[model samples]
Target: MPVLSTVGGSGRSTVAGLLACALSAMGSTVVLDTGPRLSSPWPAWSSEPGTGLLSLPPDRPLTRGQVHAAASRFPAPDGGSWQVLTDHQEWSHPPLPLPSDPAAWYQLSAIGGWQAVIADTVHPVAHDVLTARWADSTGLTARWCHLPFSVPVLCAASTGSGVLALQTAVKAASAEGLPLHRMVVALAAVGEGRSPASVKAAATMLEPRVRAVVQVPYDPRIRAHGIRDTSRLKSRSLEAGRQLARAVVSSAEAAWGDPLPAAAVPRTRAAAQARVHDTARIASKKVPA
Candidate 1:
C-alpha cells in the first residue's frame, strides 16, 4: 500500500479530497478520510458513524477478509472500489485505537495493497497517532506533506495550528531517515492571484528537507465550496486541480519505480513534447517581436 500522509491546516481536507479525486481519475483505487474525523465528504466512506479506521480491534490482527469487507462498503467510481475508513468516534486520543504495538498498526495498513491512502490528520490526536507510527517504523516512506506558501495562510483568522504541527512532525520524520517526498505549498485563498515570490521563498526554505516543492495555486471553487463527491467542479478549477494532482502522482511513481501503464505512455510523451514546443515558441517570439 502506498500511503501518503497529508499534513496541513483545515485546508488539508481539501487537498486530501482533491488528491483522492485525482487518483480515482487515473484509475487507481484510493481510500480517503482514513483518519478519525473525515474533513470532507468527497470519496465517501461506507463505515457507520461509530465504526472507523481506529475502531478496529488492535488485539485481533487485521485479516484479508476484514480488509475485503471494509473495502466492499465504499463503491468505487466507474465500477472499481476503494476502501474508505474513518477514525473511530469523530475524535479520539492519539495512536487511534491505542494500539498496544505501534508496529502492528503500520503492518495492518501495509497489508491492504492500497495504491494510496490520503489522510487529513489535522487534529492533535490524529497528529500524535501518526507521529507515534512514524517513530516506530523507520522503513515507511513519507510521500508528501502539504504546507502554506505564505505567512498569511498560517496566520489567517480562520486558520488553525495544524500547519505548524505538521511541519514539526515532518521534521521529526526526516531526522529518522524517512525521505520527505515533497512539500505542497498552497495559497490561503483563491482568486488572490499567483504569489510567485511567496511560493519561491517557500520552496527554497523547504528544499533542504524535501525532495521538491510543489505549488498549488489558489482555486476559489475548492476554497469556497469545499470537497464534493460528484464531478461538477468548475471547468477551469477542475483542470488546475488535475494539473497539481498529476505532478504529485508523477513524483510518487518515480520514487517507487512504478511504470506508467502502456496506454498512458504515449500520451505522457506527447504532453512532454508539447511543453517543449510551447517553450521554444515562447523563446522565439521574445527574440524580436
Candidate 2:
C-alpha cells in the first residue's frame, strides 16, 4: 500500500510511519520511503543509517536477504521490528544515486517476508494520474499507484485547505479510474479544536465517494520533537493509528481480494522505453536518473 498525499506538508511521511507502526505491530511489515531523501526523516529515525535501496544491485534478481540487508529495523509493538527501506546516504551534489527503476522495490516486497509494505510517496499522485502524468511517468509513482493490489491512503491535514485538497485528490482518483470506493482518506488533526464547518461539510461530501474518512489527533510531541519512540506517543494517537490501519486493510481486501496480486511487479524494457519517449515528448520531467 502507498500512503500518498494530495499536497506537500500534509504530514504524509508521518502518516506513513503511523501506518507502518500499526501494521507491523500485527505482523511482518516493511515501510519503504520513496520520497526525496534529502527532506525525508527516515534516516534520523534510527541511530545507525540503513544501507537503503541504493545498496541493492539493480542488474541482479532481488532476494529477501538483499532487501533485509538494505533495510534498517525499528522496534514494533509485539516484540517485533519493522524494516524500513530508505536512502540514508549523505550527499552534497546535483542528484542522489537512487535506482532509476522503481519496480525493484516492489519486487522485493513481494519476495520479502512481509505482510505489508507502506510506500511513502512524495508527489501528488492522484493529481498526476488525473492529468495523464502516468503516461509519461517512469518513476515510483507510475509503478505503485497504478498497481492492482496497491491500496492508496490519501492524506491531508484537518483544516479548510487540507480538506479541500483531499477532496480534489479524491475526484482526481475517480477521474483516473482508480478504486476510490476502496481508497481511505486520512484527515489528520493539525491543531486542538473542533473542525471548521467548511471542513466538516467537505468531509460529508467526501464520505460517499471513498471507503472511509478517518481522523488522527494532533500530538504535541510529534509536532515538537518528531516521530521517535511510539511508547512516548499519546495513547489516543496510537489508537487513531490502529483505526487507520484497519481501514487500509479492509480497503485492500475489498479492492484486490484477501491476498493482493504477487505478479505485475517487474516493469518490462519496452514499457520503460515508451515512458521515456513519452515523457520527453511532453515534458523534461523525468524521475531521478
Candidate 3:
C-alpha cells in the first residue's frame, strides 16, 4: 500500500519508514521512495545505504522485471530480507528527479514479489502526483494524518486542511470505483496540545467513514530526529513504532487477504482506539517539563 499524507509534514514519511522496517522484520518487504525531493530518510538509517531504486536508470522506461532485477536486499533485525528502493540521487549537488508517472511505478511494484510495498508519497492533493495515480491504478490508497482535530501538529496544516485534502483524495479514489478503505491517524503529542479525550473524539468522527483506522502514538524521539534514526528512539518511541507496524501489518492482511505469518490477533476498533488514548497518556507522562 502507498502511504500518503493529506498535507505536508504529517509525519507520513516517518510512518512510512517505520511501517517498512516493521514489515521487513516480519517477511519480505520493499519500500519505494516516490517523494519528489533531493534527499530521503530511508538511506540515513537503512542497513544498506548505497543500494536503492536510483540504481535503475530514469532515462529508460521502468519495468517490473527491471525493478526486481535492480532491487537490493537490506538486513533486518530478524535476519529477514528488507529491500529499499530510494529515489534519492547519490550526487548531492544535482539531485535526480523522481519518476513523474505514479501509474508506471505502481505497476512495476505490483509485479515485483514483495510481501508489502510502501510508497512514501508527498501529498494527496496539491503537491502529490503519486497518490492520485496510485489510487487511480489500484483504486485504493492509505492516508496517514497526524493531529486530525484541525490543529497544526508537525509540518502539516490544520486538521481542517488535512481533512479537506483527504476529501479530495477520496474523491479521486471514488472516481476509480475504489472508495478509500483504511486510514492511519497519528495522534502525536509533540507539544502540550490536544487532550486524550479530544484525540479520541477526533478519531470517533473518522471511524465511521473508513473501514479501518490505525492510530499511531507520538514518540518524542521520532519528533526529534526521524523515524529512520532508530538508534535515537527510546523505549516508548520504539514501542510506539512497533505498535504502528503491527497495525499496518494487520490492516494490510485484512485489506488484501495476504496471508501473514502467525502474529497477535488484530484488535477490535474500539480496543485499538482505546490503546491510542492510553498512548496519549504515556506520551504526556514521558514529556519533559
List runs of model 1 lying over 4 Å from the truth. Answer: 1-10, 32-35, 38-51, 71-82, 88-105, 123-178, 181-191, 204-209, 217-225, 260-289
| Pairs that collide, model 2 | none
Better of 2 and 3 by lDDT: 2
Best by lDDT: 2
TM-score for each predicted model, relative to the true structure: 0.52, 0.82, 0.62
Model 1 C-alpha lDDT per residue in residues 1-289, reported as the tens digit of each score: 2233324343555545555655665654434343433343532433323245543565555664565444423332344434455554443355453333323333444455454555433334234445657577422233222211100011111123433444555565556544455434343333455454544454466657554443444555556555433244555544544654665655556654466332211123346688999999997884654
Residue-level lDDT of model 3, residues 1-289, one tens digit each, is: 5566656656677666666656776666777777644545655545545435656664455556677656555554445556667654455545755665555455456556565666666644433335446544331232222111111112222255444565555455445444344444444444444445544555576557554444555667667666554555555555655766665555556654667443222233457689999999898885667
Pairs that clash in candidate 1: 35-87, 36-87, 53-86, 95-129
| Model 1: per-residue Cα lDDT at residue 199 | 42
Give all candidate RMSDs, comma-separated. 17.5, 8.1, 18.0
lDDT of 2 by residue, 164-276 (tens): 88877777666666777877888888889888888788888888988888888898987876666676788787788788899988887777777756545555455788999
TM-score of 3: 0.62
Error of 1 at 208 (Å): 7.9
Off by over 4 Å in 2: 99-102, 133-143, 258-289
Number of clashes in every candidate structure? 4, 0, 3
Clashes of 1: 4
**What global local distance difference test value does model 2 have?**
0.75
Error of 1 at 192 (Å): 3.9
